[model samples]
Target: MKKWQLQDIRIRDPFFLKENGEYYLYGTTDVNTWEGNGEGFDCYRSKDLKLFQGPYPVFRAPQNFWADRNFWAPEVWKYRGRYYMIASFKAEGRCRGVQVLISDDPRGPFVPVTDGPVTPTDWECLDGTLCFEDDGVYMVFCHEWIQTGDGCICAAKMSGDLTKLTGEPEVLFHASEAEWPVIHREFDSEGFVTDGPFLFRDENSRLHMIWSSYGEKGYAVGISHAQKGVIGKWNHERNTVLEKEGGHGMIFEGPEGRTLLVVHTPNTWLKERVKLYSVEKLILGG
Candidate 1:
């Protein structure tokens, strides 16, 4: 068996799924993740976080695929007994957008399910993840700062089958909205960046979101508590969750019910690697 170490893998926007005693990992898997043509998403299976097995190919692009490059942030969710993927793609002249794919198995050859990108065709969007809210399912994604000059985390209601968006997206907050000291000049003409929005519910059903932004140090993670509900106002923690090179993050339960935050480090173009840190304290209470 070929064993793998977290530092040795070049994956971004890492997402972990805990099944019946097995951990399934998914993320951006293109050989050249930063640019050029994209192949598709892949999966890694493991009983423990360390020594992952297999770069199991999950979804490969079909012929005449709309987007050929910039495949990023592939997040998988088990919905209605079907595995669905929400990832970003970009073509030559078209703006980056999030699209949906479906498969019968978690580690599968997923095929495009949606007619096209669920996000606005002209809007620059990415890092879309599935959000199951009080009323319905929603897509939480980032509107790139490059396009709006002030990146934002937005949420939109999804159809029951998760095929399309049923409502207009509402901005939950901006990159500079967090209550932390930012070292980088993100609020200036350079623009603030908002990436990776994942929702986690505490014991009390209180909702908290983990997202990425550049801070006083560098690529950082921020946690926000939803004041109302899933789509409601969110209050940011005063300090960054991880004020290091690791930014884009998602939480998953590891062995012995240990909460782990999986994120990519260095924030580089293609040299990024996923790292995990214990986050049990964050999920103790609701």
Candidate 2:
């Protein structure tokens, strides 16, 4: 296997997952992510974060697959002994939505568990992340600003088996509700965009979410605290945790149990590379 330095990998919405003793990385791997025929997702693995091996193909659209373009943000989760992938997909005439895929291994050839997206067929949605609670499993996703002027983070209950959505999605919050995010005029003239929504709990067990939108500088990432629980009221931090042309991040406990935040920087096609930040330094001033 050919080993590549982390700097050599160009990806977007970088999702870092640690399983067993190895770190696995997944993301939008296409060379041209904006427009073109959709390519499947891939994964890279490393014992240490500095170097990786393989663009091991994890998923590919099968014959008669519903979506032809814009395959984005594939997040893999281990649930009940199976690996589940929640990712966004869109065809030329269809509204973009998140779909569920499954595999038995972390480095996978993941296959869709559903024929289409679990999100409502009529709604434009993306970045669907799984949130497990005592009550049930929920999928937190973005309702695209292109369809709604103020993009929203919404949650919907998923069946215990994780094959389908059981209820209508409940809006958790909108991009405009946060003080930092500004209208991304170039992308959508009348909308406040929301890119990614990732949920994590603090040391005290209080829920928090980190998501991205255009801020004072450019694309940025910010944290919001949940007043109650997963679907409860959220309070934005008023300032971004990361900015200067980077956004769409996720948190993971890396080697030696260090909590790290990973995001693609420059917000430019092909130039983007995954960068890591310490959560303590970024948020807690540690």
* Best of the candidates, lDDT: 2
Candidate 1 TM-score to native: 0.93
Off by over 4 Å in 2: none
Specify the highest-TM-score model's number.
2
Instruction: Report the lDDT tens digits of candidate 1 across residue range 1-286.
Output: 4678767878888998776688888988887875678988888988877878878989888998899998998988889988898899999899999999998888888899865799988899999988787699989899888888778899999999888889999999887777663534432457788889899887788888988888878888888989987677888888888887987889877888777888998888778898888786543332
> Model 1's lDDT to the true fold?
0.84
Q: Estimate each model's TM-score.
A: 0.93, 0.98
State the lDDT at 168 in candidate 2. 82
Scanning candidate 2 in windows of ten residues, the lowest lDDT window is: 182-191
lDDT for position 237 in model 2: 91
Q: Candidate 1: minimum summed lDDT over ten consecutive residues — where?
A: 180-189
**lDDT by residue for model 2 (1-286), tens:** 7798998888999997788988899999977677888989999999999989998999999998899888899999999999999999999999998999999999888998979988999999999998888899999999999899999999988999998989888999999999998887765356898989999988998898999999889999988989987877899898899877778899999878899999998799889999999999997782
